[model samples]
Target: MRYRHLAAASLLALPLVAFAQTAPAPAPAPAAPPAPADVPLIARTQATVPQPVLGPVDQALRVTPATNAKGGKIHMLPATLETTQWGWFDNAQPPVLTVKSGDSIALETMMHAHNQVVPGTTIEQIKKTRTDYPGRGPHSLTGPIFIDGAEPGDVLKVTLNKIVPRSYATNFNVPGMFGEFPKEFPDGQVKYFYLDLVKMETEFLPGVFIPVKPFPGTLGVARAEPGRYSSVPPGKYAGNLDINEFTEGASIYIPVFVKGALLWTGDSHAGQGNGEINLTAMESAFRELNVTVEVIKGQKLEWPRIETKTHWITIGYDRDLNIAYDLLQKETVKYLVETKKAPDEAAATKLMVTNWDCRISEVVNVVKGTYCMTAKTAGKPVAKLPTAETATAFVTVGTDADLNKAMDTASMAMINLLVEKKGLTRLDSYGLVSAAGDCRVGPPAGATKTVVCQTPKSLWRTKTASK
Candidate 1:
């Protein structure tokens, strides 16, 4: 049951509405560049807004992505910063590392077997590795990477680049693990696969080949709730989503929760069918996963969805297929209303009935789910959060206490632009300058001028209704 609701973030109605009709308008030119490191943002804020603790701005906000010397994306070690310790995905857990939008991460994921099924591994020995795994689900996880500037009400785009197979991968079915036909295979089954990374496929049996469609079966961010969370269920936050669409070259867009969108993923599956009815995909230990994780501001989503080269996939999970089915349809309807902006909800439903392909994602994860995909037009990207390099101020608001330092925390670029380029006095710019706090345009209460992201008006036609 815990594994069933592996997704942690809930699917709320979003304002990033471009789902229905043809192409969305082209995005306007990006605002100016990030202010020079030496410039300060302290001059144009209210006396109350807190100055931000200028830690690493992270390459995410920069013009180019962060890179390493080896020409590979930054490598994330399981035991390193921001990475998770075991398998469970808890938002309350601190991040092992901080990355930025458009950053590539090459992470090594532990197998569902963890260290249980090595060459001399045994069942009795494997049980010890699953010590606290009952509610945590089965696999070992790698991270809770903190993406800079990510926050609740935003979106995180996970683009799969590559899945490098490790030397060997393992698979097993416990006695009661596959509930549908529990009696069919009573004894636990442990099997291993010799990875063929070069060929990109694995053998199920002689002459029976299964293409290696490696995807993180349990990829997601923390739920808004603060506590230990199960990696079993797939929710809006997309943990253990298990959908096959998450294979290489696909993109998963998830709603952001908590600042920096604490994200983690694992449960590498070399292959699996839609229902995963028999339990487990072609399980594998991935040597490396090349992924680009970025933040999309101004986009809102109710569910964790997928965009492949061919389809727009909507997902829903629940304890009951019937309920999950309804949730799936409702999400489709929301897709019609928000993204499609269908004037008639009923009409959208009718069209959806004709176009959507709803399939069983899984039935065993106590939390069953149905994922529906519809033929979708490609090319239009969800309008991004505004990027005003100048004239706009930004800030980070953690507690009510941070308000006092707002002025100091504001971007120096904003102050410089208004005073130097735009010719507004510091106080006047502070008056009209807006942070994400309160939308008041001119010195309205709580202007909290700090590094902030606001929706650009032109993209109003872009998508979801704001909460």
Candidate 2:
């Protein structure tokens, strides 16, 4: 019986006896739940704040309305006059106003004339005489917007955001009136070369396109005296500086005067040369300016300074270039010694000799001036320094072979720090890095096969030091 059972088992173990058979297979891990479709694609976008507006005046400044048959009507806001004058005074009281840092202001002018399209005339002269002297007529002008808190010793910082010219006309040069070259030049002899603005294009050259930028030629704060001041010359209070820098994205520092810094701004120019040689730029009707004002306490400046994204310019005005240059040099030397606090005179002198970069703002203007030299500091030139909450750190984790993964992870961390920890707008944070950041990866020191990441010392230090 045992032999028969063994024989049967052996027969069952044979390959032909069992043949082949299979069971069902399992399904794939669910397909990843499809990922959320609402995730943002872009990292950031530039943001802008709404600008503020100033309407017709009240008790602070006297407001008067004047009308014209040809041009239209305008609202005039005059400053408190200590004394009254019959003619155009060289020192006119600057408009008084108030503002804070980061606020954008716009000035609008409305005026009318019989010959809507003539040029080369003062607004007062055009209105009273009522004669089309070919090139001389009253062109409506406005502003030298005075910022509040600007005083005798401090600087008034103005950041121009935008300037627009809504209307304009041309003035043909005529004999006997102002701006006539040589007395012998006949009256109305100059052809009608002036442009009457239905709208004309500004061409810098044959192929280049120049956008129209309008600003007040006479922007300045009020004088310190109790009496009415003239508007002709630019003084410590800042009037009629004729600085071309009043354009957009520029920061202008004006000497402060009086309490609340009575800032009056008007007389917007569509465009003009440095000297205003012909006594006019693209004389037009009404200009709009978007500006921001800031007051620096206890900052006494002898003259105004201007800064832009690219340049740090100093304005020195005097009777002679030598005097202006001397003043500029003195200011530059003081700035270096005081602000930078170079170790000693030799160190300061070396800095000036080795790294100083300077240039002329405009040499031919009637306002004899020399814009002294200086190079913009080599780093992010922000309007204000970064705060701890806004700062960021960039760390290097590994060699080049692993750089891509490291950067990807590091960037995610940075985003998290900005959005979750710092409570800043994601767009602003990204923009800050974009405009003022740099990254590099290269072979590590003394390591032939390894690489390290690096960034500008200033930015990196600022992030680490919270300064």
Candidate 3:
């Protein structure tokens, strides 16, 4: 099933999920400003209780001995200024913590804006922090946890074991920050909530409560490139995906780029919607989050893929929604072919249209995201997808800031593939690709925008002879 988006105006008017856990409703908050004409009356309030103070930066990165199923060592990572990256993913950033391939991490992740947003903290204070860190992302990512054996082209298997969050959260959107409805509400707003950890829910307004489904909003390995990259837009390395499906019981496979797969994760969220329209969710910190990392050698992945009990998710990112959708479709079809789930491109398309579910991952990020999900039982289950190089008729254009240039590069590559590999005349190759080639956008963020085009492998398969 797809995730739901929580609209800004009607916080509780939209549908919400029900959980078995229950608790007494919390008291109303102290009245602050009167609701705007468009905002709900119940939504205007401030926390009377003092927010829990988070940290004094831990001087030394430390780990204590703990047990796991694989008998792997556990590392306890605290969310101190010294431990977390302010707002960037840089391959050059040295690892603050190192672990074995199969070791588990019992870690703490901070809230948005580098754990600066808390009860009684004013919007002006947040603005000052923004000015303080001029070019960095707001997410307080906690690592560059170098796995001892990970290498380029390998896949890092991350399994979510547990996530328990702190007692409060903040949700906000800045006026000029390009949220879904920035123009409608000129004066941006910020709101807070008290999470009942025992019940796993949070109070949004007087009677409205949202379930506390916690997940790390940003998780990725170091990029192959050298420079520091903003953590706002997610790319091939899967940073700031903001996908809610990455909760407890879900596993994500990330393609490793740099040596040791320097993994970093943060941007903790108590809960979020499908699109994260207001540019934020119940942004909060985690008390204790557990994950197990393993390095799978020989296998490869062009983009990140997620797995849960019932579904397998494929992702795509691009500035254009349509191109993002196409990119998702391309990844799905490519996965189907390489995993032997579909006989060919035509069959894969049929399967997708008939059974898969597509949803928007997010819209607020600079590079928008779209993803598709197919039930685990749709076909023979694949433990992992093969490398993109295995495909005979596919070309992936690397990320570019310009969307047009990215597509053009992919188009040219496809033209050459048809001419050189399929033995078609150059003119015919161009026409054929223009008419039948499927183009999709892949990982995109900051200055990276990737486009991939794949023609049917059956195009080169020997046709049957007829009498």
User: Highest TM-score: which candidate?
Assistant: 3
Q: Candidate 1 or 2, higher TM-score?
A: 1
TM-score of candidate 2 on Cα atoms, chains taken together: 0.48
Give stretches of model 1 more than 4 Å off: 1-82, 131-133, 341-343, 378-467
- Candidate with best lDDT: 3
lDDT of 1: 0.57
TM-score of each: 0.63, 0.48, 0.68
Model 2 residue 145 lDDT score: 45
CA error at residue 33 for candidate 3, angstroms: 29
Worst lDDT window (10 residues) for model 2?
A: 1-10
Which residue runs of candidate 2 sit more than 4 Å off their true CA positions? 1-102, 110-148, 169-211, 341-366, 378-467
| Candidate with the larger TM-score of 1 and 3 | 3
The CA lDDT at 150 in model 2 is 52
Residue-level lDDT for 378 in candidate 2: 55
Compose the digit string of candidate 2's lDDT tens values, residues 420-465: 6445444323322222222222211232212122222232222223
